[model samples]
Target: MDTTYTGDVTPGGAPDVRELPHLRITKLAVDPQMSNNCYLLTCRSTGESVLVDAADDAAALLRLCDAALEGVVTTHQHWDHHRGLAEVVAATGATTYAGAPDADAISEQTGIAVDVRLQHGDRIVVGDQSLEVLAIAGHTPGSVALLYADPDGHAHLFTGDSLFPGGVGNTFGDEQAFATLVHEVETKVFDRLPDDTWFYPGHGNDGRLGDERPHLAEWRERGW
Candidate 1:
């Protein structure tokens, strides 16, 4: 299995694929305007897969699957995150999952009902593997991060827009929102996971927990 993927991608370009012992992760950038990152996680053993954030470009996303897709998980209710959700779900008949608080908004936006409303500590099974849901509110009332604890190695986190390389997601200058996002990220993520944990964000590149650990205080102080 290859673990050297850089997670770099561009809209309308090919996806960056990473092969783990039990899972295969493909990161694709969609929506030129939003530059949203969509991830497909496949269980090697069972051939079952789950797509995180349909984002946009239904044709491209469907091609990425290449076969059956078990489910789609939207991290938040942001419009850019689910632009292609309805189309993808219609074609693949995949179950839709999203954080409870944002489920209604996502359903309203996409015209597709969320099959499962996830909460913190919930487990989403994809074939033989499962992802733990870590609800990190602030970016949105229901923003969630999916954590896959690789039995063979360290954990992999699909953080959506709640956490990123430099700092937490945009809180729109709301001090309360910023505080909530940063606090949850530190407590639920940094304090709980090891430094080696690799994180995949909703947009742009991926990062390691260890690489961003030292700057947590700085991020908080800056109040972004």
Candidate 2:
């Protein structure tokens, strides 16, 4: 199924999985129409893959799973990010997971109940890889991020919409929400995680913790 990513490619446009050798980080850029980033993390040892954010184009996402899909984790319940949730869940029958607080909210929106309600510090296993859940509420009350470290100690973070490259996600004009997001990003993402950690956002280009480190104060002072 060519799960391995090829060349020096940047993620955008048509969906394709970019496989990383150090750790099998499959960046599945799904739903070109929406340009949503759906990631598939595959364990080379067991071939079991976990799909992050089944955003759009269910058929394309299902094809990327290639029948080895173990589960689907919805980063947040935002409509744009979960358009294909019900379809993918119905087809694959893979257990759907979401933050505990947002489970019912997401289910109400998508019509598919969350099988697992993840909380901060919970662990989700994809074959040999273990993803640690970090609830970074801001963009949505239940917005979350998943952190996984490969054998080489490199960490990968799947940040739904809380943390981004230039600044924190939009707060819809709510100052408190923006503050919550920045605090969470500082404490959980920036303060705890290392510089080299690669983060895949909900949309657009991916970024490293190091890339956004210098601008933390600026983001906070400006307040998204």
Candidate 3:
């Protein structure tokens, strides 16, 4: 299991978790080049951490999180973002959490303990950090969006595939869900969360919620 990330993201040609995020993010460009984003929210003050969106080669991400990793948070149950969950839990021995309805979907994809099932209004307490679970199910029947905020008001969101920069999630479920996604992003995410919150999506690139807020609203108006 040479699960280390030895690709182009290395330093001196070596995998560099140091560069990943001395604080809370480790994006990996996986095989087939889907370039998904995973996260490790660490509170140096409390010495505890939580991982979100387990990518392929879990050991590598675990190595980046160190031993203080206490939990796993899947923004949603999508293949590219959660395929290595079993390896992550095995490496870190942390409890895994996801949307309540998507629990089985996540379990089937990642053979790890589903310690907690979250809902739209659910709050995840990890050390000193608190994350709110948003049910933005449009890309899939049970898609979820995870949002974290600090006491200082700094925020981070894992928008699975439900919301992206300049675009929303791709529809692959009941046709009505696409409409739901449209409304959800506007009323739930765009109107609810502040524009400055960092949004780490499941694919392509990462950005701020504010950066795409207008587009999200416009998309909804267009009936997309």
Clashes of each: 0, 2, 1
Model 1: which ten-residue window has the lowest total lDDT? 62-71
- lDDT per residue for candidate 3 within 7-84, as digits (tens), equals 234211223232222243455545456666666666646767887777776666766777788888877777887877
Task: Please give the distance, in angstroms, between residue 201's alpha carbon in candidate 1 and its true position after superposition.
Answer: 0.2
Cα lDDT listed for each candidate: 0.95, 0.82, 0.69
Whichever of 1 and 2 has more TM-score, that candidate is 1
Tell me the TM-score of each prediction against the true structure: 0.98, 0.91, 0.82
Colliding pairs, model 2 = 5-19, 15-29
Model 3 residue 8 distance off true place after TM-score fit, in angstroms? 13
Give the C-alpha miss distance for residue 214 in model 2, angstroms: 0.9
Model 2 ranges with Cα > 4 A deviation: 1-23
- Local error of candidate 1 at 176, Å? 0.5
Write the residue-wise lDDT of candidate 2 on 1-224 in tens digits.
23344422233444445555434665666554656788888887788888889888788778777667778999987887888888888887888999988888889988999999999999999887789999999889898899987666567899988877798899999999999999999999899988998788887777889989999999989978
- Indicate the TM-score of model 3: 0.82
lDDT: which candidate is best?
1
Off by over 4 Å in 1: none
Report the Cα lDDT for residue 107, model 1. 92
Best to worst by TM-score, what's the order? Answer: 1, 2, 3
Candidate 3 residue pairs in backbone clash: 195-210
